[model samples]
Target: MNDQRLRLDLAALADEVTAVDLRDRTLRTSRRLGIQRAVATSAAALVLIAAATGTAFAIRPDQTAPPLPADTPSVTATPTPNQSPTPTPSTSADDPSGAPPSGGSGTNTPSVQFGKLFYGPADVTRVKTAILRSWRPGGSTVQLLALPDIAFKGNMSVSSDGHRVAWVDSNNNLVVADADGSGKQQIRSNVDPYCVGAAWSPDRRQLLFRELAEPGGPGRFGMLDLRSAEMTVRWWASEPAACNAVWSADGRTIALTTDYGVTLYGADGTKKRVVPGFSRDGWSTDDVVSLAPNGSRVALLRRNMGGGDAGDVARDLRVNVVLDTRTGKQVTLPLGGRTLRQVYFQTDGSMVVRVQAGSGYAVLLVDEDGKKISETAEPASLKDMQILAVVD
Candidate 1:
């Protein structure tokens, strides 16, 4: 919501935009060409035109960091997988014996201080509840109400301002609401409840979501124009296929991973760039990408082989790799010994990855140079935590 304006010269990239492969893609040709004009605007400040819905607000070049809610917590990160961590007894500022602190006595109280954090809470359960934690604000913990009747299927995305969240409800309805758990609205209904992907644009003006008609059924990708109430389909798979939809941090690009490599698309659903390398691996319930804030780099979690029991599958599986989407350059993270589950990008140009540790999951902050910074406290359930947002 920053009023700051960034003027970009789109004329230089106009040729590249037009040269993108638009041959046999699923997006409509007329619509795609129209979007190219809007994105490659010759005006002073590049504009976004949502056709018929009018123009979305001029997107500021710099993304604003999400705000810290009153209940944010301070956190202590655990060590790497090889290190044997010594159990540190919990202590309070008022007491030296590491005994329980007074004041709250079971009630939730706001922490006095906080730090920069990347948050990912536990998954929603049948009890409609999950535990929320902070990576930096010094380890405050709270229980958040999971949306009614839905276990979080794939990912729950928090907008840039940290005020709104978008997820799929148990009914397969795309739900948007305030972060404080108010103003719950189901934007899309009567679709498949097995929704897989949900993400918010950097400006928080739109959302990208995908769902299937049923298990192993056809997949549909749609963009919800928050300001104009327009739902546009970017692509609809003819047969059953895995869809991994990722919106760039700059709010201008979207990447969809099919059995092939990643297909890059414009904000208006036009095909932009296609960088092929990803395997035609089997469809995973957790197919995703962690795009850098500047839209330069991306981290992908490649699924290895596993079957039979769930525990056995989780034990020996998966590898994460960071790739420069433009040059096809990649750097593999040193997470070979652990089961890497999820990956995300922090605003500081670092990577926030969630890895399976023991019976739970730990959030690791990795720098842009691909060095491990620290690992936060492990959550009770590995299935619960997915990096939601990063606050600096």
Candidate 2:
């Protein structure tokens, strides 16, 4: 196939890939500062739309892409129960089931812990409560804590070491606690009218959170020092605006996304440099970007924009590209037919991806060269199964 034809094919396939998660869409539109919410990676529903006079098509960052299909049904499944040999959170029979794929090992000691958070039935009786759980990847799970029914628009974050979890509590306090819900403590009260995003420092001793100045309005970023129990604004910008921040594994540099591009910041909140060849355009409004374990690179998903009827636009496409933080060089892996849902970089530079599977999704580890390392069996329930941190 010609290069042009191949581009068209990839774009079409990308459009067809769908995973419905309302929280992701809300963040893209709202960009509240809090925890990383799960993005949708549902089913394949590709359609080809021919380009029109006003439509521009390009595979570069900062360009508009196709929007996700409208009204994609939300995923609803009863979390199946599983047996675990390790300690796990308290779970009811109807709780979401989580365990390593079969043949992985029933007694495998987990090097990493995964966080699973679920909100209630959005169908008839609105159960506004939220539940958070922690589990060793491919192992057993332990219930962390549960929040009484509240507005479902905020965020929850877990530390890279997987030993700590944080979120905004009912009293609008920034709460940090042990992964298993022990030693719970409030870090800051009324940190923001809405605490929407939170990220831990590499050492897990500090955290940066985004809080809306007002409901659904642009907000500033703040940092919390756990030892001192002090919280202060991080000076993310001279003015309040939406930006996404992630810390390097060493905690020396922070990658912050702006309307222009990605910026690096010193731990003391000093500006480093604007990353070349990295544009904030074409990304889902929420900043779907991840820092490499070494902090020298980043991976960001394209914000797909669709136009024209399925017949006129002729295409729908999306991609995840890795950018070199130092040189701003980018690498796009040829995933073939895989629909990306969640992505994280390992300490050795390999990438672990969660992609769409039959009615659900599965986890796979791939090398930098786009080669598959290993993949776990498809879990029976993906509703609340979220991979929070990876330990190799």
**Top candidate (TM-score):** 2
59-90, model 2: which lDDT tens digit per residue?
Answer: 00110112211122111111211222222344
Candidate 2 regions exceeding 4 Å error are: 1-126, 135-137, 147-153, 193-196, 210-220, 229-242, 276-285, 304-319, 326-330, 334-336, 368-370, 383-392
- What is every candidate's alpha-carbon RMSD to the true fold? 18.3, 15.8
- Candidate 1: residue 46 lDDT (0-100): 30
TM-score to native of every candidate shown: 0.55, 0.59
lDDT for position 136 in model 2: 36
Residue-by-residue lDDT tens digits, candidate 1, 1-392: 23332223455455466555644442443332321222345432232111111111111111444422211221122112211111112311221232222211122212211123324333232344443323331233332334442323244566655555666654456787765566778787643333333667777777766554433232566666788746644453332243445666556566655444555666666666655455435312133355665556656654432321111111100226666677656766646377676566654455656677667665565665666655554434223445444533
The C-alpha lDDT values of all candidates are 0.45, 0.46
lDDT of 2: 0.46
Q: List the lowest-lDDT window of 10 residues for candidate 2.
A: 45-54
